[model samples]
Target chain A: DAGVTQSPTHLIKTRGQQVTLRCSPISGHKSVSWYQQVLGQGPQFIFQYYEKEERGRGNFPDRFSARQFPNYSSELNVNALLLGDSALYLCASSFPSSRASDTQYFGPGTRLTVL
Target chain B: AQTVTQSQPEMSVQEAETVTLSCTYDTSESNYYLFWYKQPPSRQMILVIRQEAYKQQNATENRFSVNFQKAAKSFSLKISDSQLGDTAMYFCAFMKQGSGGGADGLTFGKGTHLIIQP
Candidate 1:
């Protein structure tokens, strides 16, 4: 089966603008998570959705938001984008039934650049 | 909140030689999990190995093995016969066991860049 998939492999926006990133979880997976990876640093968790409900959220600001669809796909929206918002946005998926020890599979990520 | 640390910013080793990358994490939760993920220039995070806090034995996958010390809070990865393909950014991550059935987000370290010299 295919791994988690993300869209618009790359994106560019100016400061004060907005952008939406999309993700499709792996088949049969019920949970999706979002992470932001700045250049030369590790990824930081942004949001996690399970069974179409918001399960967890990271320390990111309110300008960042996400939602999961009935099909388990997810979208991350960043408003009032700052230069600091430029980073590779990653999406991960896992089976909720597997519980805590489940390993999340990540996507190639959407590279967002803000000028 | 939990914090994962990778002290080594970078490391270089000759091909076919063994190298060990170190990591340490701070967490009050006893039923947590630790992981080592590798990200090549391609930029997708790949799971190398994982260890559960409750497990006494370390996790091993092919040439990859982990030394998981629950007390010391140290989790290190050892690569045997390292190959050029092994070159990548290595990250140590932590996840607290959640009471709910959903998966939790991972807290990652800054990562160590590992170079396998040819």
Candidate 2:
């Protein structure tokens, strides 16, 4: 079975520019969540989408937003990006919803660089 | 909000030896899940082991086992007979109960860089 897949493995963006990272969840998975991992730090939750609805969000700034598609694929959009936005954006998928202990499978992640 | 902490920023162990990585978390939710994920140079996060709050017995997988002290809110992972393949940044995570049978994305610690020598 194909696992979670993320697009644009690497991206380069300038400060103030916008970037969008994509993720296609595993087959039969309904929930997708995004995380940002800064260099040398563990990942921090960004946003979660289940059934095309936003379920939860983290302490990130307003520039970060995400949406889930009908097929469970997700897009994380960052507007007015800052230098601190340079990090790896990871997409993880699980079945049902976020409250369950369903194991989450993660993608390789998109490495975003801001200059 | 739940917070996870990995006190060791980095640790090194010789191959075939045992090494333990420490983690502590703070959460108000009585029942939740704790996870250990490994991310190598490739940046793909892989689940190592997980422990449910309700289960008193520690969870073990292969050579990986957790020293879970529920009362102390401490969850540590022990890797026996380590291999060079074990070299990676291991992150401890906590996930609380969200509505809807969904698995909440984890709140991760800063991570411990585990380096295994050949």
Best-fitting candidate, measured by lDDT? 1
Error of 1 at B7 (Å): 0.5
For model 1, state the Cα shift of residue A60 in Å.
Answer: 0.9
Local accuracy of candidate 1 as per-residue lDDT tens digits, B1-118: 8999999999999999999999999988888878899999999889888887889999999999999999999999999999999999999998877733324599999999999999
Off by over 4 Å in 2: A97-101, B101-104
Model 1 docking category: medium
In terms of docking quality, how is candidate 2 classified?
medium
TM-score of chain B of 1: 0.96
**B13-84 per-residue lDDT for model 2 (tens digits):** 899999999999998898888889999998899999988888999999999999999999999999999999
- Tell how far residue A41 is off in model 1, in angstroms: 1.0
As a TM-score, model 2 comes out at 0.95
True contacts kept of each: 0.50, 0.61
* Candidate 1 off by > 4 Å: A99-101, B100-104
lDDT of each: 0.91, 0.89
Which lDDT tens digits does candidate 2 get at residues A17-111?
99999999999988899999898788888888889998888889999999998988999999999999999999998885444436677999999
Clashes of each: 0, 7
